[model samples]
Target chain A: MRNMLLLAQFEVKKMLFNPRGVIALAAFSLVWLLILLYPIRGASEFLISPDYKALIEGLFGPEVVSELFKWSVAELAIYWIAALYLFPLFSIFIAADQFSSDKARGTFRFLTLRASRESIFFGRFIGHMTIQTILVSLTVLATIVLAVSREATLLMPAIGSGALVIVNLVIVLLPYTALMAILSLYANSARQATIYAILIWAAMSITIAIINNYLPIISELKWILPGSQISLMINTQGLGSFAYAPVALLQTLVLLLLGRIYIKRSAI
Target chain B: MRLIECKDLSKSYGSKQALKQVDLTLDAGAPIALVGPNGAGKTTLFSLLCGYITPTTGEVSLLGHKPGDAALLGRVASLPQDATLDPNFDILTQLILFGTLQGFSKKEAKSEALRVLSLVDLAGSASQKPKSLSHGMAKRVAIAQSLIGSPEIVLLDEPTAGLDPANAKKIRELVRELSSKTTFIISSHNLDELEKLCGQVLYLELGQLTQSVSMDDSQQSQYLTLTMQQCDSEKLLNGVMELADISSIEKKQHNEFLIKHNSEEDYAIESALFTLFKQNSWQYKAILKGRTLEDKLFS
Candidate 1:
């Protein structure tokens, strides 16, 4: 347990505290700032306007659009559409090279000498989650503040709903980040991991679409693409906040287990 | 008690075997030198010992536990052949992280890093990034990292490979000083340095340990290399031939002779030769014991 924590501490410092990490985080924060202050705020206003209300109702169905009047739930609709898609993209760039760069530079030679292989693998995974939490927290805070300004009495409920938004968004990224961790094990460098991440995402999406037509029985295999259940997690479809949480958690555990096996046997 | 035990340990990558059928048992607190040519399995053996790689054919143990086991967490450490530090962090910060993994508290870890830096003569370079330091300085910092938490078994592969002569000598001295507390398995191509530092020598070739010599008992004192003035060579050799302890003498180099005596401790022969050289007015240089590692390996 202590070794795991120590590895996590080093991993966090590598991804969030270094100069490159600082630059990446800075750029990400700027993008999130724009997201919170502009489109996110604008989407809420436009969806409720009479000109677009019918359009949104028709697109999303009247039952789902009716919940937008409730301040606690309205922001989730905007937050989901804005943050959920952007979160996975943001995650790929931030954690693309987490494991690969260490191997490329021979740093793992020293690391594996003292710490257990499992500690290093899981520590890096947890460390990526930590960055995910930080980014999520800041974005949610800005969105809640914007929601509170437009409706003063909605502050308390906004906090609760905002908490749900961050949890759901973060959970949705876990399996994806876990897959990236696995990618890094095979990649030569972080840059290669980043490139592989985008290519793999597109390739998997195409494969899932193509295979679904002929092999409908294995439709559930689409979940391997990561973030496939984002809509289920955000739950604009009337499922509970945690309906997809267990599946995401299960996928994350399975990917992490595979990573542990690979790292143990693979040459550092 | 055996601090390390390996029986028929072997490792292979694809068809290339790095180590084969190796066997060894060692106790604690003795500095052992590993001498070998490049690609001679020195690094592979160190990796297996430190748990970076597992043996393919045999079992191995460190401090009576598996090499990578948690029981040996603070007890074993290594200064790998590669000195690549994370260019992002300063030396002190990295050492603190290493110290933390070795089980020191944050504050204690910092102090320990500071202490080790001081040991390696890099007290002022604590805040310096690894990229900012020269290869030699970076190597020292890497050495300092291994010394953290006062590890009992420290495996150093070419610890001073890139250092200047002076720094290399100092690191040797540091190893000698630390030998009292830590058991060191140092692999280096510098036989002279190893001869001066190590108590035992293990010669590895073609993925196998060919010979192991205990340096303390290496010199049998029956032979000595005697160097005298060029003009006095004949006179000194002829005079020394008269000594009662002498068995045979051969002129190896100009004014140098390889003298074989009758006993392991040739004190009587040495004293007799001193008198003979003084009488003949020959400048006597050094009268030393049997062959060095280089001589043994080459011969």
Candidate 2:
């Protein structure tokens, strides 16, 4: 327990001190600011015109705006969809350097002195999770504040959406974190791990889309992907639904198990 | 009791074996020097002792416990060859973190960190980040971190690699002072410094232990350079040779004769040689000589 705490403190210190972490937070804030400043006013018009409303209504049901609003805030469906790409990219960027950076800087030796390999691995994972959770939570809070301030009528809807977005983001981040931790342990270089992470993210995204269109039998496989599960949860207007909760939970467990195994078996 | 013991330890990276069937033992209170060239397996040996890397086919024990075991880790401190501090953290923070890992509570870690930073002469730079410090200062901070919990055994790998002479002298003095209560295994290419600090030495060559010698044996040679009248040279040399204690004599030049004595009998032989010079009415200019550990180590 002491070793784990020490290592976690060190990991947090590493992240806080990294210049890229500051940059990432700044980038996220800027994106949130832009979204709040410019609302997607013509989004419905471009995607579904009044003529197609009848067709859209048949598929989506009569209360389209109410359903859209509920889905948007209840599950943070739109934001979760966007985070599919954003969260994985963030995970790859934040965690790709966990082990490789330490190895490159020669800090692994220093870390090993205080803690065992197991403590180091799990400590770093927990620290990254904490940082991710805090960042996403802050972003949600900021967006809600901005949206409510812009129009009082959007307050409850914004608050609801923000809460769901945070939950979905946490779910989406878990597998990416696990995958990146594994990459950090397995890869010799940070660049190689990063490249591989990005490639895998892209491949998985494309594969999910293809499977969703062509193979109905294995379409459920899409829900197993880290970002896809969150996207489904967000679009379904059910934050506590079994469709999203059980699958995300299971995926998280599997990724974490595999990550721990890889780290334990690794050479350094 | 032995502070460290390794029996027929071996380790390999892929097809390249870094450490062969090596056996070593370190006692509780003696400071040992590990001297070796690059790739001589010095770091590998330290790693094995620290449990950073497991041995492929042997057993290593620290304080009678297996290496890397929780008990061993709690009692052992190591200053790795290329170990780096977190660039983002200040010196004090790093020290405190390492101390906590070594079983100190937060308050205890803070106080111990302060004490260790002072030992390494890094107390003033406690707030500076590692990236802001010079290479030597950073190395000193790393050393400070290892001394945190005051473990029973401290393994320092090239502890003075980047320090200037003055800093190196300070570190050597600190090690000397600490060795009374702490067992130290210091690895370095600096023979003279090692000689000054270590009571025992382990020399490695090509991943093998070539020699292990005690400092007492290394200090046995007594070579004296006597500057006297050219006429008295022959008489002095004869007097030195006649003494049973004199092992060998080498004539370096017209006036200088290198004298060797058996063990610590140099004082007796020197007194005799002076008596002979006094009887012969020899006029000597000056006599300058001392024991050189480097000579023993290299030769």
Candidate 3:
């Protein structure tokens, strides 16, 4: 357990201190700031306008707009929605090189000499998760600060909703980061791992669509995919937003186990 | 203590057999050399010992534990051939991380890293990134990591392959100095280096790993090599052959000969040869005590 934590700390240092890691963090910050600026800060008036409210209701129906408005503040709702999608994609990028480049350079040979392969694999997974968590929390805090500036009365409520948003976003990112963990084992570079992820996601979507069309009996298989619960998450509110937590957790568990198996059998 | 033990070990990759069924044992003592040609099983055996890969068949043990066991993490370490340090990290941080994983405290790990760096004469480069250093320096840093925690056994694959002679000699000196308290299994193609350092040699070829042979008795040689300073080849050969108990003499070069003789006739053979040389007024360059590792392995 101690060795595992030590290895995880090393991974965090790599992501935070390395030149490549600094560039990645910078890119994430710039894009995240733009997202916060345009959607929440710049469009606040349009979002709360009467006609826009009507437009949303007319487009999706009263249920989604009512569910969206159920949040403590308007900005928090926008931040929650944007974050659910943004963080997962960012996670795929940040965690793509978790093991691939290390394996290529033979650093794992050095690591495995002092730590077990399982420890190295899981420690890196935890490290990437920790990084994504920090990123998500910072963005959520920024949105909350924005909410407080618009309405001081909403601070307590915004904090509550911000906490919930952080939880939901973290759960959503679990499977995505775990997917990259398994992919890193097979790829020789981060680019190859990212490409493999896109290919897998595309191939699975097409396969699921074909199955749903031809074999309607097995349409339930779509839920097995990593992001399949996002559509359901869109209309849920409060604790209901956690409805898909079990599914995300299951996907993460399965991918992590498979990754552990691969690392054990590999020659690195 | 036993350093390594393998019984009928074999390893295969799909259809290719990298190591055949072989049994071997090594005990704690002087350094051991792993020598073989390219495509030999030298690296494969090193991997098996370090538990980087599992054997396809048979059993292997290090410090009385199975290879790759958690119990052996700090007890065994290796410098795998051509493996590099992660270029993204500075040398000290990587070494400290290795030390912590081996069960040292953070403070202890730092000091240990510095100590090993000094051992390799690389203390000043600790804060520099691996890419900024030359290949030889980087190789020395890699060797330093293998020294962390003062492991009971270290497997070095091509430890000095790319190093300049001076740097290579420093590493050789380091290994020699450390061998008193640690067991080293070094794999390399440099026979002269291996001959100077290793007390035992394990020859691997075509997936077959043989039993360990003493460096002094690699060929069980009762032969000696003689180098002379410009002597008449005919007179030298004839004079040496007339000595009692001398088995055979072959001229290896213009002034050198390989002489094989009875194992029991040590003093008599040498005294007679010296008397022959003195009579012919022959000036000698060197009289090697035993056949070279090259002769033992190839001759």
Model 3 DockQ, alpha carbons vs. true complex: 0.86
lDDT for each residue of candidate 2 in B211-286, tens digit (9 for 90 to 100)? 8888776345466656566555556667778877777776666676667777464467667767877887777765
Evaluate residue B187 in candidate 3 and report its C-alpha lDDT on the 0 to 100 scale. Answer: 93
User: Can you give the TM-score per candidate against the true fold?
Assistant: 0.92, 0.83, 0.96
- Candidate 3, residues A1-268, lDDT tens digits: the string is 8887887787888888878889988988899889888897765656677798788889989976677766667887777677777777788888899999888988889988788889988899888888888888989898888878888998998888888888998899999999999998899999999999989989999999999999999999997889898867877767888988999999999999999999999887
Summed over model 1, clashes come to 0
- Top lDDT hit: 3
Candidate of highest DockQ: 3
- Candidate 1: give its CA RMSD in angstroms: 2.8
TM-score of each model's chain B: 0.90, 0.83, 0.92
Tens digit per residue, CA lDDT, model 1, A1-268 = 7878778777787877788888988898898778777787887888667778788778888776565544444555687777878888888877777688778887786677667888888888888888888888988888888888888887887787788777777888898889899998889987788888889878988999888988999988987767788755443522355777777888889988899888887877
Sorted on DockQ, best first, the list reads 3, 1, 2
Candidate 2: pairs in clash = A73-A161, A77-A234
lDDT of 1 by residue, B1-299 (tens): 68889999999988999998999888775699999899999999998988877788999998888877878876788898774878899988888887887778999999999999999899999999999999899899888888888889999999989899999999999999999999999999999899899888999999999988887673456777776655466666677788887887877667768787786453777788777767766776677677656766655
Winner on lDDT between 1 and 3 is 3
